[model samples]
Target: MTAATPPARVGPGRATWVWRRWGVALRFERRSVLVCGTLAAVVALLGVLALGTGSLRLSPAEVLSALFDPDADPRARLVVVTWRLPRLLFAVVCGAALAVSGAIFQSLTKNPLGSPDVIGFASGSYAGASVVMLLLGSADYLAVASGSLTGGTVTALLVYALAHRHGVRPFRLIIVGIAVGAFLSSLTSMLLLSVSPQQAMLVATWGAGSLNGLGFEQLRVAAVVLVVLLICAATVVRPLVQLEMGDDTAVALGVNARRARFAGTLVGVALTALVTAAVGPIAFVALAAPQIARRLTRGATTLRIAPAALTGAAVLVTADFIAQRVDLPVGVVTVCVGGVYLAWLLVRQYRGGRR
Candidate 1:
């Protein structure tokens, strides 16, 4: 093991630490480390709280025992592991997935508000799932999941095509996404109106997004998919970070700006689609997590993927915990909470523009 080298750069109250060992160098900022670590701890604590506070109401110790000790009480193990654990894990994974997706889009567009929710990917996904539920009348998880992925992918392609005048510019992509999303929303509403009230209600309930009945089966597949998507996200991070500095600068630095944007967009949409497919369109996590993470880290770095992911996990776990107590869909909790945050964000942006 090599000794920790001194920070390469230092400022008034900031330093960038670089650790090199066996020909691999890792760069990190202290603030980013602290923020990511704190968020991870929060997520873990919230996960325990969530696992412990269900109908049976196990103590934290009981939850830990049930999780780790195979010889724990049968009932306790059944409740914590067989029942509540999947939902908790889903909240964490889905939240992280959504947040990372948001980070990618926001970085690509260089806009705070650029998220799958705002740009129509979520809407498209919901629309797709609604078609499976309403038209096909198939409530099978796999069928609906396929519809969602298809719908979101097609919508992204459409948006990309429309936005590609010379190249896929960020501003144009956002505008096109908004318009496409609106169209998809209206189409979904029309489908709902055309369908039986029972079908409409079913789709609506799923759209509300709860982690009520998810089990290890669903979690297993989603975890695998998220891992793959996140790895792809990692591959694009360096180029995306360079692109954040402006296309000309990125080009000067030997980064492929257009390719990076396209790859980032693909990965971001896939992440959103993964979550939407698993639990329906849980709104605001994708929109709020990255921004919240960025602020919590005080903009320590341009690409705050890890912090955003951890922040997202914490936010979703916390919201799911609240939802479990209140018997409401987790999406409802997020919307109510995220709506206020969105309003404040809009006001702040407006004021900033005026200044």
Candidate 2:
């Protein structure tokens, strides 16, 4: 085993911790931290913008005042506090959770296309939700959320059972998930087909994924879950970084490869399930946030959790703001935007590889 070494220099004025022991090497740079901080500040600024802009536009100054002063402008209070605030929090919290979850899956699978849905959670959530609307005639928010959780749990167990061959192979797990996701999606479609027009419309609207009508209660629950999942992420993140060097290298570095894989899988699925439960499977934030964060920070060798989470928060809040103005579901906007980004990402990756 090697002794704890001092911070090493990476770039000018950038300090890093580089450690090696038991034939394993690990390093961390201060740059990621700095980038994450900047991104967090930007996200906060965006939150203010979200609070300010709408049919009733308040300036950033007014937004801040309304936030702090209970007896501020009555209109600002009504809009900011009772109307827009909870949705903004939902966008930020859910977006960050999805981005972090996506990052975990992408790192786990070593595939850029790796998303929270890659584990079948989206389909499962939809399936559960659709069942609630169609079979049980329950369109209540809590009922839908409960159904989504149950479906996600079923999908997770099924995928694990199919994918486990001695241990969960990353590629195999992804393949199994895709296959099961397709099946679950079909189940949702069948339910949609069989239901009455009113029921179908309800399920369809929810499936389109809206941040509409989110409140303090939902945000409170999501916040607690996200906090716990984040702690789990922190404890297992080092192993994730190590695994990026390859499974053998990860093993040499004292990382439990199977355990890390399962942890990532668990976190990724749970995050997606919770978000889907809250807002109905929001499209593309999870898939794009990590990639955008990596680009913005220029950090290829690290997980970039903070930057990714911030980017997701920014993206979703901005989308929600746009949705508010247009009276469109936030999910629809994300899907449209995500479709373009996904195309661009594929093209860029292809060009880079050819180079």
Model 2 per-residue lDDT tens digits across residues 136-199: 8786667877887788777877988998898667778778988999999887888788878887
Q: Candidate 1 at 327: error in angstroms?
A: 1.0
Which ranges in model 2 have alpha carbons more than 4 Å from their true place? 1-28, 137-143, 160-176, 351-355
In order, the Cα lDDT scores of the candidates are 0.86, 0.82
lDDT of 1 by residue, 1-355 (tens): 6768886666666767888888888989888898888888888888888888967888889989999999999999999989988999999999999999999888887877788998898898888888888888787777877888788888988998898897777788888999999999999989988978887887788889988889999899999998998899999998988888888899999998768877887888888878887888898888888888888878844367788889899999999999989999999999999899889988998999999
**lDDT at 300 for candidate 2?**
68
- Cα lDDT for residue 178, model 2? 87
Model 2 poorest ten-residue lDDT run: 297-306
Q: Could you estimate the TM-score for every candidate?
A: 0.93, 0.86
TM-score (C-alpha) between model 2 and the true structure: 0.86
Q: Please report the TM-score between candidate 1 and the true structure.
A: 0.93
